[model samples]
Target: MENTGSFYNRLTLQALAIVEGESDLIANLSNISALLNMELENINWVGFYLLKNDELVLGPFQGKPACVRIPVGKGVCGTAVKDNRVMRIDDVHAFPGHIACDAVSQSEIVIPLNIGEKCIGVLDIDSPDLSRFDQNDEQGLVSFVTELQKVL
Candidate 1:
């Protein structure tokens, strides 16, 4: 298998190319999911929860069964969407009202994906290691999301 960052670097470039070509959103999301699973090391889950209508519905993901419906202000994922900011949790258990989709997950980083200045979805990543994400990830994810929004 490819090294984690190497995988993300490859896929991120691919996604950028697709965005430049104005390709499909669903296909883009699917590729993102695959990239997260393949690029991020020791991750239990990585995917998106897209806001549709008024609720957050599950989008393309690379993991086991996840919570299908998340309200506007529920778990870490929900709270991120509701707050419209990145929520980086070193320990999910410590976060109040954290919805435990997988008990094995220790840390999580959720970035709100915005389009046209509207919060449309969330990019969520989970890892089994404590403090799996940091400022670097936050910056990298922000850049990635910025790139993603160009065509969405």
Candidate 2:
């Protein structure tokens, strides 16, 4: 198996290749979600929640059906968008105000998608294993998001 850094580096490169010259938002997000689902291991859910009218509306996803709408500052996805930062929860059950979209989702990481000073959405990944993500994952995913921002 490849190391985490190498895995993410390849993942980010693939993402860039997929989105290159693709100006359609939905198309880019859809392809990205599929890429993450195919590449990431042990993750039950991987998708995007786009901010709309101060709320998060479910976008393209690669998992079972999820919550359609979430208010800002409410759940992991919401808090990330509200604070304009990444939210990585080792255990979803312990998180106050966590909206359980999937009971099997034990750990989650939410990365807010920002365009300059405004947050447009979030990239949310949920894992069934506890503490499935670490600092390395965070750094890599942040880099992935940074590359994604350039095209968005």
Candidate 3:
């Protein structure tokens, strides 16, 4: 297996390549979600939720359908946006105000997508296995989001 750092390095490069010339936001986010679905193992859902009108609206995703809207500061995704930080829950069930879009999702990670000081959206990933994400995954995804911010 590839080391986490190397794996994310490649993933970030691939993401950059994929969105290189694409100027459309939805198209880029859709493709990114697809790319994550194909590369990340043990993940059941990968997607983005864009901030709109003080709430998060589902942007693009891979997996079963998810909640369409989340109020800022409400659920995991919302809290990430409200706090402007990444939320990595090893066990979603224990997380207060965790909105269960999928009951099968045992673990989750939400990375707030920011441009300067304003948060635009979030990259949300879900897994069925407990403790599916660790510090490495968090750092890697944070790096991924950092690069993604440049393109968007």
TM-scores for candidates 1 onward, in order: 0.88, 0.98, 0.98
Model 2 C-alpha lDDT per residue in residues 1-152, reported as the tens digit of each score: 89989999999999999999989999999999999999999999999999999899999999999999999999999999989999999999999999999999999999999888789999999999999999999999999999899887
Clash statistics: count for each candidate: 0, 0, 0
Cα lDDT of model 1 by residue, 1-152, tens digit: 76545644665687677556556777888887886687667899999999997788999999988999889899998899888989999999999999998999999999998889899889999999999988777777777788778777
Model 3 stretches astray by more than 4 angstroms: none
Model 1 lDDT vs. the true structure?
0.85
Prediction 2 global C-alpha lDDT: 0.96
**Global lDDT of each candidate:** 0.85, 0.96, 0.95
Segments of candidate 2 deviating more than 4 angstroms: none
Evaluate candidate 2 by giving its C-alpha RMSD to the native, one decimal: 0.7
Q: Write the per-residue lDDT of candidate 3 for residues 35-149, one digit (tens) a residue.
A: 9999999999999999998999999999999999999999899999999999999999999988999999999999999888889999999999999999999999999999999
